[model samples]
Target: MKLSVIGSGYVGLVAGTCFAEAGNHVICMDVDEKKIADLKNGIIPIYEPGLEAMLKRNVDHGKLTFTTDMKHTVHNSDIIFIAVGTPPDEDGSADLTYVLAVAKAIGQYMTHPKIVIDKSTVPVGTAALVKAEIQTQTDIDVHVVSNPEFLKEGAAIDDFMYPDRVVIGTDSDEVGETMRQLYAPFVRTGNPIIVMDIVSAELTKYAANSMLATKISFMNEMANLCHRVGADIENVRRGIASDRRIGKAFIFAGVGYGGSCFPKDVKALIHTSSKYDYNMRILTAVEDVNQDQKTILIPRILEHFGGSVKGKTIALWGLSFKPKTDDMREAPARVLIKTLHELGATLKAHDPVALEEARRLGLDKMVTLCEDNYEAIRNSDALILVTEWLEYREPDFEYMKKNMNSFAIFDGRNIYNPEKVRSKGFTYYGIGRQ
Candidate 1:
């Protein structure tokens, strides 16, 4: 199969590379000539574990290719995937300019019948919109399918190669069959290939992400209540997570959830609901909870420092949203950094991979970026574990104690045992652990 994935962003790059690895000839097309040139030269922009090696191997084997020529890519491929970014608009709806632009280009260049898959997370009915836009350009037969991606950033390759289920949305039986054939290699483990209406398929992506975000918000709220009641949220989380119906997934009490997906999808879903004059009350509260949860620890830190963080040097470990990825979009660490800076507190921050991103975001001027975790803690008043990266799980606590002017641990992810840290003659604060 010859497949062309438009927009060499995160989704497009991963999907194109994985499809090529599965024996399909893939051409990843982007309008950015510089990005295409970088890909051709084996320069990957993002850091996903195992992606660089796999992509390099596929490119070397001639299974995968990159191009800036949209006409060439569209005319040569049987399947076209619109995996472009649908960034949120000011009103919170997904900005469909990129997706629609790709669709129009496909219509203009396509010479034969093609299956166009909307792999980007778009609002419901976007498939219909894409189909309508394409039909205006050419009379060629085109089947627009709503095939949303469910790839996790850190584990995208594994998720693509071994999806729990594949959802294909198309009214035509021929289109569904074609999509199933393309995804057959991935679902060989007897996982379902769910075929549904295009609208349902588009909504599925938003619903899935919102539900996960709901879980994170609910746990964060529970953690807050636990703090007030003098109870441990971890104990409560463990108690409830044991239920068969609610088997644990995103129940950890963290600062909040942030990434390209959850924050955008939740806003988009709420915006979509509003278009129909319907209010998604639960999701609205979920969003509110999350916004506040991102900086929930600020007050605690302030109170601990006698109501002023002025002239204090705080050590922050982990700048990315979560472990194993360098993505810092809407990261809780950003909230911490901003608030601490406003309070006139100095910061020494360290992450395994996000230092370059921090520099790109101009965070270097606001905080001291350290190459190592220990270096970040040197001469700092307190250590705050923000992202819970595996490297920060266990460290030389004695050495950390000696380096810091004041020994205090604010465990945002609850990765450390409060008792163990306190045993080292240091003050310890974990989310909702009394």
Candidate 2:
């Protein structure tokens, strides 16, 4: 099948590349001429693992191409996927300006019937809006299918190549079958291909993200309670995670959840529910808890310094939201850095891959970005583990003790053993570890 994926951002790039890898002729279209030119020269914008190699292979094989021409995209493709971003509005609802604009362009350039899939995460009833927008431009028959992506940032290639389930939203059985055939290679292991109405399909993406966000908030809440009660969150996590019903996935206590998805999706769901005159009270709490949880370590750090981080030199072990991705949207480290900087703390930070992104976001003005992890801890008063990167899991404590102006370790992700750090002649503070 010939396919064109509009908006060659994260989702569009991965989806288009994966489709091409699966033996489909794919053209990834973007309005940015520079980006399309970069893709043509084998330059990928995002830093997703395993993506560059796969995209390059498909391009080398002539299975994939990049273009800035929308008319060519609409005319040559049997299936066109709208993978544009739906960033949150000031009121927290998803802004569909990009998605609707793509739909209008597709309608205007259509020469015949085509299948348009809503691959971007949009609000419920967005498929209807897309369909109506397209109808206004042409009388040619068009089938709009809601096929929301479930790809994770760091592991997007694997997730696309082997999805647990494929959800296709359409009223037509023919469209459903067509989508199933397109996704059939990925789900050969008998994972479900769920076909449902457009409304349910749109809601599924929000519901799935909100539930994961809820789990993260709930665990963070529990970790805070454990800290007050002189209990260990790790032990509590182990105790509860043993139960098969509440199996462990997103239950680990951390600073908070952040990315392109959770923060906006939770707010969007709450906003969407309110529009229907129904309040999502639980989701509202989930959003509230997550916001506060981002700064969960501030009080501990302040108290450690007798209510002042003023003139203290603190080292941060990680800068990204999580490991293996350079995305810093709503990263907890940003809040920590901002607060610490305001309190006159000199900051030194390092991440395996996010140093350039941090510099691009102007974080270098507030904190010194270091290339090596050990270089970040040099002469620092305390070391704080922020993102839980694998390299920070085990460290040379002897060197840390000798090089630091002070000896204190604040384990935000609870990846350290408090007893071992204390034994190394350094003070150790861990979340919910007592």
Candidate 3:
């Protein structure tokens, strides 16, 4: 199949590259001329693991190409995937302007019938809106299939290559058959290719994200209660996870979940429910819990410093939202830095991957970028473990003890054994652990 992914962002780039790797000729189109030029010059704009190598290989093989010309992209492809960003609006609803713009552009320039797939996570009924927009511009028939991506940013390549199941929504069997054919290669291990109504498919994306967000907040709330009751949430998590029904995945208590998907998708669902005068009470509380959870370490830091961070030099380990990627959108570390900075504390931070991204976001000025983990502890008043990177799990406590001004450790991820860390002559604080 000849495919055109109408965006050069994360989803589009990955999808176009992967599709081209699967023997499809792919043209990636975007309005940004500079970005198109960069892609043509073998420059990948994002930092995703294994993406650059795959993209370079596909480009070298003449299977994948990038362009700023929409007309050429529309006419040359049989299937056009609308993989643009659906950024959240001020009211929290997904802004569909980019998706609709691409649909109209495809309709205007398309000289033949094409299969249009909604690859971005948009609100329910967006496919209908897109179909209407496209039909208004052209008399030719277009099958607008709702096929939301289930890829995580850090592990997107693996997710695309081996999806657990592919949910393709279309009323027409013809469209469903076409989608199954496109995705069959990925699901050769007998993973399901479920075809359903367009509305159900749209809601599935929101429901999936909302459920995960709910679990994170629920665990955070549990962790908070555990702290008050002098219980360890980790033990509780283990106890509950053993139950066959509950199974552990997103049940871990941390500073809170922050990524491109959960925060925006949860808010969008809440906003969508509000439009119908329906209140998503559980989701509302979930959002509330997360907002407070992001700064859960602040009070602990204040307590350690006797209610004042003034003139305190704190060393912070990890700055990314999570680990394995440099994407810091809505990262909890930013919230911590902002809150701590307001209290007049000098922060020394270190991350294996997010240092450059942190600089790009202008967060470097707010905190000192440390060269290494032990160096981050150099003459610092206290240590805060924000992101749970693998390297920070077990460290040279002697080096930590030697370099730090104080032996107080505030672990946001509950990573360390409290007794062991305290044995190293340091005060250790972790979420829901005593």
Which residue pairs collide in model 2, if any?
none
Clashing pairs in 1: none
From the highest lDDT down, the ranking of the candidates is 2, 1, 3
Off by over 4 Å in 3: none
Worst 10 residues of 2 by lDDT: 425-434
How are the candidates ranked when ordered by TM-score, highest leading? 1, 2, 3
Two-way TM-score contest, 1 vs 3, winner:
1
Task: Report the lDDT tens digits of candidate 3 across residue range 258-302.
Answer: 878899999999999998899999999999999999998898889
lDDT of each: 0.93, 0.93, 0.92
The candidate 1 region of ten consecutive residues with least summed lDDT is 424-433
How many backbone clashes are present in model 2?
Answer: 0
TM-score of 2: 0.98
TM-score of each: 0.99, 0.98, 0.97
Question: lDDT, candidate 2, residue 128?
Answer: 93
**lDDT of candidate model 3 versus the reference:** 0.92
Runs with alpha carbons beyond 4 Å of true place in candidate 1: none
Q: Is candidate 2 or candidate 3 better by lDDT?
A: 2
